[model samples]
Target chain A: MNFVHTMETFVEGKKKILLILLAVFLIALPYMLNSQYLVTVAVKIGSYTLLALGLNVLTGYTGLVSLGHAGFVAIGAYTSSLCAVKLGMNFFASMILGMVVAGLAGVLLGLPTMRVTGTYLSIITLGFGEIIKMIAMNWSSVTNGTLGVKNIPRPSIFGYDLTIANNGLYYLMLVLVLITTLFCIAVVKSKTGRAFQAIRADELASTMMGINITSYKILSFVISACICALGGALYASLIGYIDPNTFNFDVSTLILSIVILGGMGTIRGMFVGAAILIAFPEVSRFLMEYRFVLYGVILVLMMRFRPQGIMGWKSTMPYRLSKNVKEQVEKMDKNAPLNLLNETKG
Target chain B: MAEKEVLLKVDNITKRFGGIVAVDHVSCTVRKGEVVSIIGPNGAGKTTVFNMLTGVYEVDEGEIIFNGNPIHNKDPKEIVAAGISRTFQNIRLFSDLRVIENVLIGAHIKTKYNFFQSVFRTKKFREEEDKKTAEAIQLLKSIGLDYRRDDYASNLPYGEQRKLEITRAIATGAQLILLDEPAAGMNPQESAELMEFINKLKDQGYTILMIEHDMSVVMNVSDRIYVIDHGKPIAEGLPEEIANNPKVIEAYLGGVQNDAEDQ
Candidate 1:
C-alpha cells in the first residue's frame, strides 16, 4: 500500500507540473498574441472551457447526457445582468447569485433524471432549453426580450476595471478557467467523484454499494449548472451585452461537443476540446460559413473512429507484467497443438 | 440446540412484471451468524427474492423485516443504510474506477464527508478520507486484491472481478450480506477458494444469505438450504436434508425436463 501511494503520487506529480505549465501559458497568452482579436478568441476559449468543464462532470463523469446546458447559461446571464441592472449590485456578487439561481434550476431539471435517462434525458433537457429561451424572449420587462441586455458592467478588483480595452478581462477569464479546471480535478479525486463514476459504470451496482443515485445525480447537475452559469455571467460582462439568441440549442450542443472532443471525464481534455472548437471556425472563414456541416462531419468521424475523443484513451500506467510471457506466447500459437500431434505420430 | 435470532425475514413477497408473476408469495428467513443458501433452477425467483431484499424492486405483496423493521418497498439506498448490502448475479462492478475505488464506494455510507467538505478538502474531510482509504486498502488486502488495488476494475480477470464484487459487499459493513450468485462463473479451484472465503466470513460472525446455482457450493457452505421453484419455496432444511429430499430432487429434475421440452 505504501508503495502504491508513492507510485500513484509520482504519476500525479508529473501531472501537477504539466498543469502548472499550462496555467502559466494561459496567463501569458494575451502577451504572446499581442493582438486584441486573438486575445478575444482566447477569452472565448476560456469561457467555452468553463462550460465544457462543468458539462464533463455531468455528462462525462456521471454519464447523464444533458442537451440544455445553454439554458442554465441563459438563466445565469439574465439573472446576473438583472441583479446588477435593477438592484445596483456588485458584478462579482451578481455572478454568484446567477450561479445560485441556475443551480436551483438545475435541481428542478435533475428531478426528472430520477425516472428518465439517456435519450429521454437528452429530450427533456432539450425541452428545458427551449422553455428557458421562450421565457427569455417573452419576459420583456426584465430581460427586454429579443432586444437583449446591454452595457453589462465588467468586474473590477481594487478599482481596476477588467475590460477588453485594458486586456484585464482576458486575464480574468484565464484565471477563472484555471480555477474551474482545478475545481474539476479536485472533484474527480474526491469520494463524491468516485460515486459519480460508479453510477456511470453500473447504476444498479452503485445503488447496491449504498450510493444514493438521486441525490448524487442532483448534486452533479447543480454543480454543473453553477459552473455554466458562472461562464454565462462572464460572457455577459465580457461582451457588454447578451440576448436570448446567443443562448440557444446550438450553444448547448457546441458545449457538449467540446466535452466529447476533449475527452469525457478528463480535465485536460476540456482545454484541448475548447481550443479547437472555439479557434477552428475563427481561423477559417469557409468553416465559419459551413460550421454546422463541419460540426456534423467532426461528430460523425469521431463516433466512427474515436468515440473516446483525443485524450480519452487509457495511458500506460506502471503495473507488473506477467512473467510467463514466453510460455503464454507458445501456448497461443495455433500450430503448437499440430506440432505436438505430429511429434507424437512420428 | 440454541436457536439463533432471525437477522432477516422475507414473508410472502410477490413481484409481477406487467402480466407475468416473477415471484409469488415467497417467504424465507436468515438467522444471525448462519450461512444460508437459496438454490433453484434458472428463473426460479432466486434473484428476484434477493432484489426484493435489497429493495431493488418494490414488492407487490410482502414484508421484509430486517433487524425488527419492515424494510419491504424501501428505497435501495435506505435499505443499504439499514445495514444490508448485495452483489448482482452478473458481477456488476464499477469498471471505470480502480479496484480500490470500487471498494471505497462501498464505504460511502460510512464516510462522514459531505459535498462541501469534499469540495473544500478541509481538515475533517482529509482525516475522514484517509481513514476510509486505509479501511478500503485493508479490505482489499484481506480479500487478496491489494496487489491490484490501483488497476481498473474492468482490467481484472473474471474470477478476480467476482472476488472484487464480494469484497466490495463486505466493505459496506453490513450485518447481513446477500450474494446473488457468488460462484457462477468460477472454475473448480476458484469455486473452492470462494467456499473457503464464505466459511471465513461465517467464522467472523457475519450473517450471509446467498442465491446460488452451484450445487457444490450450495451443499458445502450452507448450514441450511431453501429450495425454490416456480416462485415459491418447495423445501427448507439442513444441507443433508435438502440433498436427499425427494421433493427437492423432483423439482430440480422436473425443471430440467421442462427446459428441455421448451427447447
Candidate 2:
C-alpha cells in the first residue's frame, strides 16, 4: 500500500513539477533580464498557439478544411474588446459573449455547407471568412472602422493587474493555452469524437449505420469557432489592441497550414504544429519576409511526402488502448492498489 | 408460413428514373419471421423494390407503410430508426473503421446519448456505449467474426465482409432487414452457407427481404417469392407456386420463345 502510494505520488509530482518550474521562471524572468521585446514575442506565440489549436479541431479530427478560422478569431477580438471598452462589460463576460457570437456564426456557415464538401466546402468557408473580415474592417459604429479597438483593459486577478509587458500577458496566454488543450483532449476521446472520425472515414456509410453526420460536423465547426473566438479575445486583451490587418485570410491560411503540418485528426500533433509555426516567424527574423514562403514550401513537401504529419494519425500512446483493453486495465487497477489514484485522476 | 403476422405492406408502388419506370405498381407484404425473396432477370426492378421498401428512393405514385405508418418519403436513417436496416449490393462498409466499430455504428438507432453527454463522456453515455459494444460483439460472434472484431472492416474477405454487413444490420435492432443481392459474388458453397445463415437470422426474429438472381439460393431460403417483369409484379406466392405461374414462366422463358418453338 505504501509503495503504491509512493509510486502514485511520484508520477503525479513529475507532471506538475514542470508547471511549477514554468510559473516560477516566468515570475523571475523580467526581473532577471527585463527584455521587453522577448516578452512581447513570447506572448504573441502563446496567442497564436491558441488559434492554431482551434483550427486543428476542425481540420484535424473532423477532416473539415476550414480557410475561415481567422474570421472567427477576428469576430471574437472585435466583439469582446468593443463590448468591454464601449458597453462597459467585464473582460470575462465579453469573452463568453464573443464565443457565443462566433459559435453562432460558425453554425450559419456550417448549416448551408452541410451538403458541400472537399474543394467546394473550402471555397465556401474561405468566402465566409473573407466576408467577416470585410465586415470587421468596414463596420464603423462597432469596430471603429479600420482603426481597430484600442486601450482595452488588462484583466485583474485579486487586485493585481497583469499587463502585456514584463511577461504578465505571457503567463495569461500560457494558462489559456493549457485550458484549451485539456478541453480538446477530453473532447476528442468522447463519443462525439468517434462520430467525427466516423464521418471523416465515410459519410454515406455513416448515415446507413444511423449516425447523424450533419449534427456532428456542425458541432465540430461550433467548437472550433468557440476555441478560435476564445483565443481571439485573449489575444486582444494581451496585446491591448487589435486591427483588421492583423487577422485576415492569411492568418486563416497559416493556422490551417499548422493543422496539416501537425497531422490533422490528432491532439499531440496540434501542439507540435503550434510550437513550430508559432515560433517559426520570430526564429527566422533575418528572412522574415520569406518565412511565409518557406512555410508554404515545407507544408507542401510534407503533405506530398509525409501526409500523416509528425505523430501520425493512429495513436501510439499506450494510454489510448482499445475500450475493451481499457476496461480490463480499469478492472485490474481496481483490484490492485492503483484504484485510489485512478479514481481521483481520470 | 403465411400464418405469421404481416409487418410491412407495399401497395401499388411505382418508381420512375427519368424516362424509365423501374418499379411499376409493385405490391407485396412481408410477414413476421419470414424470409421473402424478389427474383427476376436483370433490370426487372427487383432491387428497386428493395430500395423503395427500405426508404432509399421514394415511390412516385404509391405508398409503403411499415407497421401502418407511411414510410416511403422518410429519410433512410429515420426508416432505420423505425426498426428497419439494410446492406448494399456492392459492400459499403466504413473501410477505415474497425470491424466492431462498423457494427457498433449500426446499433446507433438504439443508443441513448444527447450530444453534450457523449462529448463529455458522462456516466449515462459511457454506460450506454459499453452496452452497445457488447451487443455489437455478440452480433459479430453470431457471424463467427468476433475474434477479428478489432481488424479494419476492409481487410475482411469478400464472404466475411458480406457476413459482417449482415451482422451490422442485425445489430441495428431492426425487425425488418433489406439485403440487396447479398450473395451476388459468392461461390456456390458460400451461397449455401449464406442461405443457412439467413434462415437462422429469420429464426432469430428478423423479417428478411432480399433480391437474389441465383435460382438455387432463391428457391432454397425463400418462404415466398415475388417475380417482376418490365417493372411490374407479374407473379408472387410460394416458391413452387411462383415457379409454376404461366406469367412467371413467360417472363423468365418468354412467350415469344414458346410460340416460335411451337411453330
Candidate 3:
C-alpha cells in the first residue's frame, strides 16, 4: 500500500511538469510564428478546437451523435452579426444573444430525443442543419441572403478594437477558448457530467438511477449548441464576414471527425485533433482537394485499428479487475469477462 | 407483524403489452419493514410486476398506492425519487463508470446541487458531494465492496456485479427495493451470501420485494411469500404456510417438469 501511494505521487508529479511545459508551449506559439498567415491559421485552429470541445460533450460524453451542428454555428454567427447590425447591440451582448438563440435551437432540435437515437438522431440533426442553411440563403430581409453579411465589425473591449491583424483578437479568442475548455472540464468532473456519462453508458440504467432522461439529453444538446454558437460568433468576428455556405454540412462533419479522431471524451485529445486536422490542409496545399478522401481513409484505418480513438480510456488503460476480484475473475471461464462487459456496455 | 403499517399497496394493477397480459390484476401489500418474496416459474410475469411497481411499465388498469398516495402512470425516475428503486434480472450497471460512481448516481435523489452550483463548485456542492461520497462508501462497506470502489463495475466478478446493483439500489435512499432474480447465475456459496445480505437489509429496516427461483433463499429469508403463475397470484402466506400449500406445490411440480423437458 505504501509503495502504491509513492508511485501515484510520482505519476502526479510527472503530470504536473508535463502540464507546465504544455502551458509554456501554448503561450509561446503565436509570438514565435512571425508570419501573419501562420497566426491566422493558429486562430482558426483555436476556434475549431473550441467547436470540437463543444461537440465532444454531446457526442463524446453523452453518446448523442449529431450531423447538423453547423446549423447551430450558422445560427450563432448570423444572430450575433444581425444583433449588432440591425438591433444596434454591443458586440458582447450580440455574442450572448447568439449563444441564447443557438441554445434554444439546440433544445428545439432535441425534441426528437425521446423517439430517436444513433443513426436516426444523426439524420434528424442533418436535416435540421440543411433547413437552417436554406433559411439563411432565402431570408434576405434579415440575413441579407446568399450574398452573405459583410464587414462585421471587430469586437471592442474597453475602448480597444481587436482588429483582424491585431494580437488582441488572437489573445481574446485564446482566452475564450481556454474558458470554454475549463468550463467543459469542470462539467465532465461534476455530478451532472457523471449523469451525462451514465446516460451515455446506458439510458435505461440512468433512468433507473433517477436521472431524468429527457432533461439530461436536452441539456447536453443545449450546452453543445451554446458552445458551438460561441465559437461561430468568434469566427465571424475574426474573419469579418459570414455566409450560409461557411457553416455547411462539410464543416459539421469535420468537427465530428475531429472529436472521433482526437479521442472522444478526452479534453486534451480535442485540442490535438483539431490542431492537426486544421493545420494539415494549410501546410500541404497540394493535397487540399483530396482532404475529404484523406479523412475517410484515416477514419477507416482508425476504426479498424483503434475504434476507441487516440486517447480513449480503453486504449490508454488495460482492462483490470480489483486485486481480490482479479482472482475471482481468473477462476471464471475464459470468455465470461468479455461477454459480461459487452452485455453491460450494450 | 399484526401491528405493522402498510407502506406500499398494489391495488389490482394490470399491465398488458399489446394484446397479451403481462401482469393481470396483481394485488400485493408490503408492510413498512418486511422481506416479501414473489416466486413463480418462468413467464409467470414476476419481473413484469416489479416493472409496474417501479413505474418502468405503466399500469393499464387499477392504481398503485405507495405511502397512501396514488403512483400509477408516474415516470420511473419520479418513482425512484418517491422512495422506490429496483435492479434488473440481468444486471444493468453503468459499465464504464467506477463502482463508487455507480452508487453516486443512485444518490442523485438526495443531493440538492443544481447545474450552476455543480459547475461553479459552490460550497453547497462540495458539502453535498462530500456527504454523498461518505454515504456511498458506507453503503459499499455494508455490501463488502468498499475496497473495490474504484474499479469499473463491469470488471467485478459476476456475483459482485449483482451485489453492486443491490448496493446501488439501496443507495438511492429507497424505502422499498425490488430485486429481480438476484441469484440467477450465482453459485450456491454466492447465493448463500446473497441470502445473508437480504437478511441484513431487512435488519436495517428496508422493505424488500424479491423474485427468487432459489427456494432455499426464499424460504430462509422471506417473512412472507406470494406465489404466482401466469400473471395471477395463486397463493399468499407465511413462508411455512407457503411451503405446505398444495397449489404452490402443484405450480412448482408443473414448472419442474417443464424445466426437465427443456433440459
Give the lDDT of residue A335 in candidate 2. Answer: 21
| TM-score-best of 1 and 3 | 3
My TM-score estimates for the predictions, one after another, are 0.89, 0.84, 0.90
Clash pairs for candidate 3: none
lDDT of 1 by residue, B1-263 (tens): 79999989888899998998889888888899899999988899888888888888899997999999999999888888887888888889988778878888988888877877877878887777766666566566655677787788889998899888877887777888888898988899989989998887787677899989899999999989988888878999999988777778777785554454442
lDDT tens digits, residue span A154-209, model 2: 86666677785645676777788888887887777555666777788767667776
* Deviating ranges (above 4 Å) for candidate 1: A1-20, A286-296, A315-346, B16-21, B255-263
Score residue A82 of candidate 1 by CA lDDT: 86
Q: Which residue pairs of candidate 1 clash?
A: none
lDDT of 3 by residue, B1-263 (tens): 37699988888888898998878888999998899999988999999898888777878998989988888889998898888889989999998888888988887767778999888878887777766665566566656787787888888999899999988888777888899998998999999999988887787688999999999999999989998888888999999998877777777785554443442
* DockQ leader: 3
Question: lDDT per residue, candidate 3, A1-346, as tens digits?
Answer: 3554565467566988877887888777777886788888888898899899989999999999999999988998999998877776788899999999999999999889989988999999999999999999999998999999998888888878986466777787788888998899879877888889999998888888889888889999999999999989988888888999999999899899889888898887888888878988887688867976886787899878977776564322222333544444334342221112112211
lDDT of each: 0.84, 0.78, 0.84
Q: Judging by TM-score against the true structure, name the best candidate.
A: 3
lDDT of 2 by residue, B1-263 (tens): 23767789999999999999999999989988788998887889987887776666887998988888899988878987787788888888877667877776676657777767865668887777666665555556556776677777878888889988887777777778889899999998989999988877766667888898888889888989988888988888999887767777777777765553442
